[model samples]
Target: MRATEHWPVVVIGGGQAGLAMSHELKERAVSHVIFEKNRIAHSWRTQRWDAFCLVTPNWQCRLPGHHYPGKEPHGFMPKDEIVSYIEDYAKKIDAPVREGVAVKKLSRNGSGYRVETQEGTVTADQVVLAVSAYHKPKIPALANDLSASIKQIHSSEYRNPGQLPEGAVMVVGSGQSGCQIAEDLHLAGRKVHLVVGSAPRCPRVYRGRDAVDWLDDLGQYDLPVDKHPLKDGVRGKANHYLTGRDGGRDIDLRRFALEGMILHGRLLGLEDGRLVFGDDLTKNLDAADAVYNGICTMIDKHIESQGIEAPGQAHYRPVWQPEIGAESFDSVQAGITSIVWATGFTSDWSWVDLPVFENNYPKHERGITPEPGLYVVGLPWLYTWGSGRFVGVGRDAAYIADHVADVSREKTAVPVASRKETRPWHGLDGYNLASAVA
Candidate 1:
């Protein structure tokens, strides 16, 4: 039998979150390793479209000690540049990352964790799951029913217009990815059919500054999930649609509709060789516009309240409206030769053999779970709106590192046998403390 290696802390990811955690752990002199299935910044390099860029400005690229160093503080970095930024941060921190080592299982091992990776098993006093929630691309079940000749592809696989078969492209879901991908196809002069969802929209620039800048000033990003009106429910909300392409600009679905883009409602499924859609196209569009104007209204109030001299702005006015859209259309007749499912992703935590999840969602107060030494970071709305983004992941990482350090101190101060008697660690409802400690 191979002897299991051990470390004080083990982080399972090599993205910005894991790198940030490594930096903080190193600062505190905590010996650790980051296990990445692929190379650092793999998602940014492989998953994103060619023209993809940050919707938020480059200044928000604050990952630990590294911040955006380019001349354009407000300009958004394209896909390649974003990858370089993360790679540069990894080099700067000297993070102990083991590339191509996929973690197969994570289970309790005598008051610590047993992380089974492809490379080998390792025991760690603390484990931080820095992998973000987007683990698997979520395509609807209806997709399987669609004719295979339609050339279906998830938004992650989509690269450019030239890659698809010649004909119109139907994009389903209207979240950030769906909207942006639709725009990418439209700009390429491809006939585009978009299935709009309830995802909200935000203006790229408002009141002579980016909407994000105003939101930052308004203390929106700092608002914690616990204090949020929806509480943890905010995590499930689709991100507001906008674009950072070509400097930055608003993604006006209404304008796209006006400019010959066929807009449909929610994808109901396939019916008798035809694609069925709901009649909520107008409703969805109106809801998106409401959010766009709502942000503008909020920014307008902030400017007035702060007595700041900013340019005035008018609320968005819908330039187009659908008139009783068809309930179902033959995709073949409509010339939609390709379909892009921009429908988000789902979390897969099956490898984590612990009872820390409730209904597929990890239950935690920030990154600290009921499983004492097990922590999760880089999750959407982990604490605040910025918890998962570059603007906020470093702060979350720092907090987790501090907790890990404290736990290390406790373990060092107390002997293993005495820890059970003096510090009796209680388990949550579904967890077994005795087994965890054993």
Candidate 2:
């Protein structure tokens, strides 16, 4: 017979999201445990590239009680620094985290959830799918037709250019990861071909301060996706071409092109001996510029309205580096020996035996699952554009905790004293069960 354990709530995937859920459960005095595939903050430890740093500043990483009290609030935190913070947090909070527990199956039990892992089984009244937003590396199906001789690797597997095969590299997609990898390859003396996409560029700093400051001050970071306009604002919706490279330095694509990167339009598909593209390189570039300008305009207006004399920052007008050429390119003629797919990543729901997906993503409203006792977090645009970011998980975590407390109360008779309890603080972010329970 297999060992069967039970918990009031079981939080899956001990990244920022799962740890956040743990903090919330801890605050509510909820009996919960975190099941991590690896150690705490596993992705930060393994998934990131060698030169990767958070694009956001240090001040934004206000996790549940594990605040960034370091001196460099504005500087971007490196991968190691982030890992250390999370590791320390997991130890300090005493999060009941079971490491190396790979959950093979998560299905519905009688009225709860059954987590079948390599260690054993766990039944929980409530379940949190905080496995993070990105799980599987997204590679286009067209990659199969290309000869295996041309090395291809997703952004997740890529570390440094030295790991790649010799010759010119074609970096598909122009988001932050793609752009950064292209830069890395170019700097390493490898000829790089950057296939620019619809990604917009935002300067790391503006007005002697970070651009994030203006957006955060304007409450843009907290704005819900439903409340936001759809057009010219996709920058906030998807990944943007910006970098925290070299301690939060800006990376402009047009500037990248000026320095010998062979830029191309959106990748259509593989053709006779070349990769096809739509004749939209200039159009896409214009759209990207529009996104950058739109944000600046909003910030400028906010500053003017507040009668604030801000520091002088130079506004930029984009000039096509060597003037973008025709759309299609001969992949073989360009001597592109390798391809880096920085397109994106998606969630893998094979382990999750549930009917909760919509648009190929786990469907939830504010992290609340339609199925009672089920919840999700760490998805982009969950409530705001920052929903999936390091700074945003705490808010969603608190919400999930409240729901868990409510569900737990429903499953059991709540005492009058417990119902009226105001202080639910267990050394986390000081949340009370009474507020959420009511």
RMSD of each: 8.1, 6.7
The per-model lDDT (C-alpha) reads: 0.86, 0.76
How far is 350's C-alpha from truth in model 1 (Å)? 0.6
Worst 10 residues of 2 by lDDT: 428-437
Encode model 2's per-residue lDDT on 1-438: one tens digit a residue.
156778888888888888877887888899988888888888888887888788888999878888886898888877799999889888878988989988999999989989999888879888898887687899999899887678999988889988887789999988888888898888788899887787777767777678888767766666655555552243234566677767677776777777777778888898875688766777777777776766666666667777888886656688654454556667767787889999898768889888988666776767787776889888776766667886777887886677689778775534323443121212212111111111
For residues 355-427, could you state the per-residue lDDT of candidate 1 as single tens digits?
9999898888768898988889999889888889998888888777877887887744233233221111121
Error of 1 at 73 (Å): 0.6
Q: Which TM-score value belongs to model 2?
A: 0.89
**Candidate 1 off by > 4 Å:** 411-438
Cα deviation of 187, candidate 1, in Å: 0.6
